[model samples]
Target chain A: MIAQFPALQVVIPLLGAPLCIILRRGALPWLIALLVSWAALAMAATLLSQVADGEIISYALGGWLAPLGIEYRIDTLNAFMLLLVAGTSSAVLPFAYKSVAKEIPQDRHYLFYSGFLLMLTGLLGMAITGDAFNVFVFIEISSLSSYAMIAMGRDRRALSAAFTYLVMGTVGATFFLIGVGLIYAVTGTLNMADLAERLPPLYQSRTVLAAFAFISVGILLKLALFPLHLWLPNAYTYAPSVVTAFLAATATKVAIYLLLRFGYTVFGAEFVFNIVPASEVLLTLALAGVIIASFVAIFQSDVKRLLAYSSVAQIGYIILGISYANVTGLTASIVHIFNHAVTKGALFLVMGCVAYAAGACRLESFAGLGKRMPLTMAAFVIAGLSLIGVPLTAGFISKWYLVLGAMEKGWWPVAAVILATSLLAAVYVWRVVEIAYFRDAPADAPPLSDPPLALLVPTWVLTGACVYFGIETSLSLGFAEQAAIQLMGGG
Target chain B: MKHHLIPRVIAKLTIPGILLFALYVQFHGDYGPGGGFQAGVIFGAGFILYGLVFGLENLRKVAPPQIVTAFIAVGVLLYGGVGVVSQILGANYLDYDVLSAVDHDGQHLGILLVELGVGITVAAVMMTIFMTFAGRLR
Candidate 1:
């Protein structure tokens, strides 16, 4: 069991999903999924310990040596990612039981759980796998399942959202495949470690540069970076609450992980930074995404859609860190990954709770939610404040590192830009705070109460996580630093 | 959905052949750019052909959508199952050599099982997606 930790990290959800369908009656599937997710979390914990202690665990598929066979590589970065993904799934599954039954039809309940499990499988697999092509395969797995999961929403907009995601996802996947193909054509290898070793020699090759371009574009689209983020707002707005929460926490996080893996692990900083000037493009787009998307978020009438735009802005903070192209920059970006996941996951889950209680969650619907659904709205306020980078919160920690990294590079303007964007976040969050707390509920509305514990527990779990990770830096930042050093080739 | 022969036969022969080719690619994964994923899709294509030629109803009779979906889960589980087996054997995930007394031959078997898992999942997922879309068409 100890030796098989890598496989267990992915296998639990991959296998547990069918068991969900089979044991569809009663609360069994949820229980199974919960147990399996915990198992995965345990595996991740063990892997994290091993990696943090500076041990790299590479599991050979069927005992074939790497550069020839599929492998599950565990280092500090991916181990942390696996923990985030599995931890989120475990956290979310407990909440999904009643929430899903309320949102989805009874007969299709089994299908929904199964799809959820598969999506989990795809995400965790992508995070943990070392093979390049395997990432694409898992991307399809997660993407296809996610499309189905999102489409299961009661609203007709769900279908259109799913369709739009499908088209965009297909395009992203195609780009990723082309990039993989190009890399393979150049080096005849698909393993990340092998690619990293082989790619430096070919740094001057136009073909390698083309591959880098394709991969960056593909990841940018997937991460919903700046101008490429058109598909995200609708998908988030229209998806079933559970689906929205899951994707908010895990999906984009995984894509960011891909970008990190490629930029730092596969391409190496020297070549990627010095050769192609990738950081300049990343920086420009990050700034645009942060400023522009924040403004867009401010005007949205629908609360969920507002947060969706806000997500694009958050993505900018992560990209800005990466574009700095140093240990501090990479660490900052990585820290934000965990921070944003905590913030967004809590925010969206609270939104789901609001939707459940009020049967609506637009800006107007939330006009007096603070008074009616006090705890839920309070959770939202806390998470929203964190997103604004308030001191003593997870979001601030990320922004702090980002600013330091920028200042270290003597890019004071970039540091100023980071401060300015944090202000944008404050404005949008304040808008929501004003509406939810200050205004009046419609006279026709019935008195609303707190959402059930099933939902609120997970909501608070992440809320607690945001503060806990903020106060206790050892878990989040330490892992991120180790991951950064590892990506910089164990500096 | 009703079954029609021309399309069915074409689906049966072509889809099965494509699946076989996918398996070949998966087995030859180390030597080439393809592996478990291609095999999974090809296998999926075969079952999809079965559904196409025999009518989804008839195919459902053979492997119902619910059951097909279950099978898809089973396939991934089977892959994971191998990992568990390796754990029980006190080795790392998918350690095939431990599965067999032979050295590298165990790895051969391990890869085969893992590929089979991917093949099953890919095949079943295709069927599941097909069922969803075909229903929409209806």
Candidate 2:
């Protein structure tokens, strides 16, 4: 059973999803989803522990041989990713129970849970699978379900948001598929490990270079990297709050993991860096994403859209770390993945509560929220602080490492930009704080209290994690260090 | 209202044959090109034909929406259950080799069960999608 942890990790959710729809009663689907998410979290924990000593755990589906059959491969990098993805789901689902009830119509509850599970399954499958083609399949699975989930939002614009996401996501998936096809054409294998072994010799081939270009662009679009991020703000803002929280935290993070996996693990850093000048391109884009997105975020009136743009900026930090192509840089990127997920998940949950109690997520809706919903607003403040990389927070640790990575490369301007962007983050976060605390509630406003305990508790748990992991730093940083080493060591 | 006797008669005649072929495709998947996905679509097509000629009201009578929704979950559960069963037998999840003493027999058994599960879910979901869209029309 322990040996099968990798498969069990994904199968439990895959199985539990259908069970959610089968039961099809109020709260039952949420309960089932909650249990399944927790179960997946436990499995991910076990898998991470198993791989903690830097051992790779590979499980062949149906007992078939690797390269000929599907394989679930767990390394330090994927193990960390699995934990992040599953942990975010576990944390977010509890909050989702109340949020979903308020946001989605009753008849669609079962479909919501089912779509959530399918999305979970897709993300886990993508992180665990060793086959390049399997990643594409899982991407589609998650993408299709997310489209459904996003469209479930009560807002009429949810339909357009889902449609826009669908069109863009399909193009991204197609590009990724074409890249995988080219790799297979040259190497005659779809297994990542097999391709890794075969690809080095073909590094100079135009086909391989074209494959890299397609795959990178596809993944960057999926990650919502700067300039390619037009679809994200509305998609995240208009989608049901739970969908926004989940996708904001995990979806782009998974895309970043793919970028790391393909860029470093499969393509090899030397070829990706020295041969193609990918680092410079990524660095330029990362800088632009951080500065431009942060500036854009500062001007947004919708809080969700603000955070959505902030997400693009945070992703820039992750990409910037990766562009350095050093252990510290990669470690910063990996650690930021977990940190940003915890921080954004908490912030979004708070926004959901505000939407629940106040009936809107616009900046003005936050007026006097600090008084009406003190704990909820406080949770937002803490997460907001983390977002700005204030000291004694998870965000600080990631930025610290990111700056260290920049300085190590003697890129002082990049380091300066990193700090300057945090100040921009501070400006945006402070806008919310000022509105929530300083402004008074309107005279005719309905009495609003903190959200129900079901929602509030989960929001705080993630907020607590943001602070806890920041101070402790052992679990997240330890895993991230090992993951960075593994990536740099060529897996 | 027109009875449309010719179309109704053709639908009535072909629906049973279509369903039978769907089952054949599902079960013969391991040895042939057709599998659960193909089988599910074919099965759903038969019901769609019935609804087109006999009316959705009559189709719903044959396959209630509530039961169809449950069927969707049941199929996925059936597929996942096989994997869980293998895990209980002390093999990896979805490790079908441990399902039977004979390796080849276990493989065949596992494939059959999984394909059946896929066929059931896909067919039910397709029907449910049609019902939802058609319900909107009414």
Candidate 3:
């Protein structure tokens, strides 16, 4: 039973999605989603602990061998990701009851939960699956479900936003498929482990190089890296608050994991870095993404849109870490995956509460919110501080590693840019803080207090984790270091 | 239009045959090219043709929307349930060899059941989508 954790990790939620539709009751589907997510988190914990020593667990679906069958592979990297994604879902679900009920129509609530579970299944499956084709399948599953969930937002713009994402995301997926097909054409294998073994000898082949290019661009678009990030701000802005929270936290993080897996494990660091100069390209883009996206974020009027752009900038920092392509750089990349997830997830959830009580996620709605929703805003502040890479917060730990990584390479300019971007982070984060804390309530405005305990508790829980993971460092840092070492050692 | 006797009569004549062929495709999936997805679409097309020629209300009388939605859930659960059953029997998820005393028979039974699940879902979903867009006209 314990050995089957990898299969069960994905299978449980895949089944739970249908169960949600079958039940079709108001609270029943939500409860089912909540349970399935918590179960996934628990399983992830067990999987992580089991793989903490850098061991790998591979489970073959349908009892077929790995070269042919769909395999669920869990290593320290993905197990940690599974933990982040599932844990974020679990935290966000408890907060969803009020926010979802407030935003979405009553009739669609069951469908909403069903979509949530499907998205969870897709994200977790992507993290755990060892097959290249299976990653594409899970990416579609997660993207399709998310498009539906995003379209569920009350505003009609949600429809167009979803359509925009649909088009861009489909193109991205197609490019990735073409890349994978190219690789399979050359190597005749879809298994990541097998592909790694076969890929090195063919690294100089043009087909393999084109395959690498397509796959990198496809994943970059999905990851919402700077130039390719047009679909994200609106999708995140218009999505129902819970959808934004969950997708913001986990979806792109999984894409980053996919990028790292392909870039380091399958393609091999030597091919990606030394032979192809992929590191230099990625490093340049990362710098531009952080500076430009942060500039864009500070100008947005809507709070959700602002945070959405901030998310793009944050993704830049992650890519910045990745572009360094060393042990410390990879560690920063991995730890930031967990750090940014908790911080941004908490921030979006807090916005969800604001949306529930104030009826908008715009900056104007946040006026005098500090007095009314002190605790919620407080959680927002702490998570906001974390986003700025303030000391004794999770975001700080990521930046610390990122700076060290840049310095280790004697890239002093890159290290300076990392610090400069943190100030940009401070600007965007402070925008909301200023409105919430300094501005006075309008005369005709109704009184708003903290949201229900159900909402506040989950928001704080994630917020507290931002600080806790910062100070404690063992669970997230230990696993991140282990994952970094394993990736560097090759799959 | 109900007044179109020729179209209605042709639909009636061919729908049964279409359904029959769908069944054949579903059952022979393990050996042939036609499987759950293709079989399911063929089966659903028969009903969709009926709804188009005979009117949605008449189609609704024969197959309600609620039941169609329920069947979608049922199909997925059925498919997933088979995998769980295999797992409980100490094989990995979807390991069909443990489903019966004979390994070959278990694999056959497993494929057949899974295809059946897919057929049911695709058929129901096809009809549901037809009804939704077709009903939107009224």
Better of 1 and 2 by DockQ: 2
DockQ of the candidate models in sequence: 0.47, 0.77, 0.81
Of 2 and 3, the candidate ranking higher by TM-score? 3
Misplaced by over 4 Å in model 3 are: none
Show pairs that collide, candidate 2: none
**Stretches > 4 Å off in candidate 1:** B1-65, B102-138
lDDT of 1 at A381: 87
TM-score of each: 0.89, 0.98, 0.99
Interface RMSD of each: 2.1, 1.1, 0.9
Q: Write the per-residue lDDT of candidate 2 for residues A441-482, one digit (tens) a residue.
A: 898989999989999999999999999989999999999999
True contacts kept of 1: 0.66
Better of 2 and 3 by DockQ: 3
lDDT of each: 0.86, 0.92, 0.93
> Whose TM-score is greatest here?
3
Model 3: DockQ vs. true structure: 0.81
What is candidate 2's CA lDDT for residue A6?
87
